[model samples]
Target: MSYPRLAGKRILVTEADAFMGPMLCQVLARHGAEVIADAGTLADDPQRPAAIVAAAGTIDVLVANLAIPAPSTPAVEVSEAEWRATFAALVDPLPRLVGAVLPQMLARRSGKILLMGSASALRGMRRASTYSAARGAQLAYIQAVGVEVAPYNVQVNAIAQNFVDNPTYFPPEVQADPRFQDRLRREVPLGRLVTAGEDAEFAAFLASDAADHFVGQVFPVCGGWVGR
Candidate 1:
């Protein structure tokens, strides 16, 4: 199906080599968006997000696709370093990226910022304290920023997703495991992993003009995993 929802729009997708980045760029481009895929990490170097936005120049949409390998340490065993690192990787770069692009969007009185967040924040998960906390911070930031910028015609929202088909979280080897299949049937109401294309298409809709009415909203794309 042809969706020219984002025709003539320039979108900047961060962490373009990882997480939802690869699929998001492909899908947005298919929807007629000019995607600026930046395969750079925003951790440690605080200046990186701004640098990426500055380089992209005049972006109509910002896809914050930040991610890291989720650490599975138990809550009691999660160290301070683990906590800090997880936040740095998944949470810290958010504001910096928004800060960079928001000025332009606010000035122009038009823009969209879609965060590829996680459902782990909305639902409880064993051995994911640090990772879940960081993801939670991301959603909260989106909610606050979404409302703050909505009046300027700049919408900020998030896709809090899990159980999606992607190399980062659900790689081939993992999906091939029978235990994983059993888990899917037992946990996810959809009884399957949500395809990358399905998730990205929704993201394309959110980034387009069609989704302007939505603000400070968290859309869960977890194949109904969060519902259970």
Candidate 2:
């Protein structure tokens, strides 16, 4: 399916080598978007997000494709360092990126910010306290900022997803495990993982003009893992 909607649009996708980044870049490019894939990490400096925005020049959309390997430490065992590290990887860069791009979008009264978030934020999972907290923070921030930027014609939204076929989260070795396959059947109502291309296509729609009516929305793309 050709998404002519994104054609000619300039989009910057951060963490472009990880998570859903490469698939998203490919899908958006296939849809005719001028995609700038940034594989840099936003650690070591608070100003990195702004630098990234500046490096992308003018953009019609920003896909915050942020992620980190989830730690399985028990809630009682989670350390402050772990908590901070999780947030640093997933939460801290959001506002900085928005701040950097807001001026340009607000001036033109048009832009889109689509977060490639996690469904783990929307639902509780054992041994994921720190990771869940950081992901939750991301969605909350998007809700607050989405409404704030809406009147200016800037859309901010998120796809809180899980059980999707992606290298970062669900690699071949894990998928081949019988234990993992059983968990997929029992836990996911759809009984299978959603494809990466499918998830990226949803991102494309959110970044397109067709999604202008949407703002401050957290759409779960986890195949009934986190039911509305």
Candidate 3:
């Protein structure tokens, strides 16, 4: 845990206040990275991603930790507005962030892009149609871009997670619910949510030079929920 695996690296973490952002910044910094924690919204402004990248000059890693409250509307009841908003919040900023930071990374022939995605995309979930669709789009984009940039040594990958402890999704009230506990035991093979630190530690590994060989991979951090 004390190893300086990310020593002297400059990392830019987006939406640093939400999702896995806080824990990720803390863990990456603990690993000796100079983390640029940006707690900004990229959904409202299309240009914000570029601005964030421009502001965080010379980034060795980009942690795209974008998130929003998942809409639980049934598939047939999912409105166009809900769909658009979901995509805007979860999927749209990806290319913009990449476009802003990738040229520099490619020029240096080095850099890592780690997306904090969702496991709902990899498995079916009732009342999660909009959220899953957008998340799936994100993973697809990462896969395509990851391969395209891998030859240039710019690795792009994602962590598809669910049943992971985070305020954005599984807050205190939800965790304390008996129904939720029963569901957790019934569905997740691990029998509990994956801790935030565990998830963040894995993310740090992915962002480190140690993970340079991985390309376009979607690592699931869902406590075996996807398997069950």
Return the top candidate by lDDT: 3
> Model 2, 14-122: lDDT tens per residue?
9899999999999999998999999967755798899989988898999999988899999999999999888988999888998998899999999999999998888
Worst 10 residues of 1 by lDDT: 219-228
Q: In model 1, what lDDT does residue 179 have?
A: 100
Q: What is the lDDT of residue 22 in candidate 2?
A: 92
The order of the candidates by TM-score, greatest first, is 3, 1, 2
- TM-scores of the candidates in the order shown: 0.98, 0.97, 0.98
The TM-score of candidate 1 is: 0.98
lDDT of 3 by residue, 92-199 (tens): 999999999999999999999999999989988889999999999999999999999999999999999999999999999999999999999999889999999999
Clashes of 3: 0
**True-vs-predicted CA distance for residue 24, candidate 3, Å:** 0.6
Q: What is the per-residue lDDT of model 1 for residues 69-160, given as tens digits with 9 covering 90 to 100?
A: 99999898999999999999999999999999999999999999999999999978889989999999999999999999889999999999
Runs with alpha carbons beyond 4 Å of true place in candidate 2 = 226-228
- Native-to-model Cα distance after best TM-score fit, residue 225 in candidate 1, in Å: 2.9
Query: How high is the lDDT of residue 201 in model 3?
Result: 96
